[model samples]
Target: MKPVRFQFKLKYLAILALAALLLGNRGFRSLVRNYREYSRLKSEKAQLEQQRVDLEKKLAEISKKPAIEQAARTELGLIRPDETEYRFPAPKESDK
Candidate 1:
């Protein structure tokens, strides 16, 4: 009777240990997943910050007189005071 009681206690302890191990493993996997997401977000934040800096520099440059004039001339097709504007016709497909 004592031997049977010992065996029952041992079995219960084994099951409890296995449950604890499974819970710990799940918690560890969750920690690893969170860490990987943190690393990805950190890298993305750096990239976005660099982009913001570049855009700010571009905005500063475009706010100036020369960059604004150049943008106007090229993008908006605004000519200088003494210049004559010319528009050429599109070529046919055979021209290619």
Candidate 2:
């Protein structure tokens, strides 16, 4: 009977160790996943910051008088009162 009792305790200890190992493995996997997500978000933040700077520069340029007039002349097709507009026909593709 004493031998049987020792065998039972040993089995229980083995099961406990296995359970601890499985739980630790799961926790380690979660840590690795979180670290990858953190790195991805950090890089995305840098890309967004660069885009924001580029947009700010564009905004500053568009706010200027020359840029506004250029947009009006090209996009809106407006010309000065003293200026005459000319339209040229496209050359034939065969000419190229």
Candidate 3:
């Protein structure tokens, strides 16, 4: 009877230890989740960095004298040295 009681106590202790072991590693799942998130953010950072580089190159080109003059002349309707500038008033709601 004593041997049976000792065996029962051992089994209970083993079960308790197993439960503790499982509970002690609760952060493992979160660690894996955070690692995945970190990788995704790193990839996004790289893509954005590349886009920034591309935009900087484009900005450099646009800042050149010829490109600036062309853009101003075409998009903003700027006049050259010999051209006459014209001003037109916006139509009001009453005119419509």
Candidate 4:
């Protein structure tokens, strides 16, 4: 009976020690932190990859002459020599 009690106590002690080591070890904490950081970085990398793909597609579109002219006219307010440009005032906002 004493040996059985000792074995049970030893098992409990081992479980407690393992729990303490897992919860208190610096390396284990760092590993958890690093895993979270790696996950966040992976998500950021995916977002950057998507952004790069979008930029590449935009670059391909703007590589064409017609797209270039459209971008210039829209972004730079440029008009062709034979075309007339018009400006309009913004509509007034009513007070609440």
lDDT agreement with native, every candidate: 0.95, 0.95, 0.92, 0.95
Error of 1 at 75 (Å): 1.1
Clash tally for model 4: 0
lDDT of 1 by residue, 1-96 (tens): 579989999999999999888777978779889999999999999999999999999999999999999999999999999999999999999998
Task: Assess candidate 2 and give its TM-score to the true structure.
Answer: 0.66
The superposed Cα distance between candidate 2 and the true structure at residue 71, in angstroms, equals 2.0
Instruction: Give, for candidate 1, the lowest lDDT window spanning 10 residues.
Output: 20-29
lDDT of 2 by residue, 1-96 (tens): 579989999999999999888777978779889999999999999999999999999999999999999999999999999999999989999988
**RMSD (CA, angstroms), candidate 4:** 3.9
Per-candidate TM-scores read 0.63, 0.66, 0.57, 0.71
**Which pairs of residues have clashing backbones in candidate 4?**
none
Model 1 stretches with alpha carbons more than 4 Å out: 1-24, 80-82, 88-96
- Which scores higher on TM-score, 1 or 4? 4
Cα error of candidate 4 at position 4, Å: 11
For all candidates, the clash counts are: 0, 0, 0, 0
lDDT of 4 by residue, 20-71 (tens): 9999899999999999999999999999999999999999999999999999
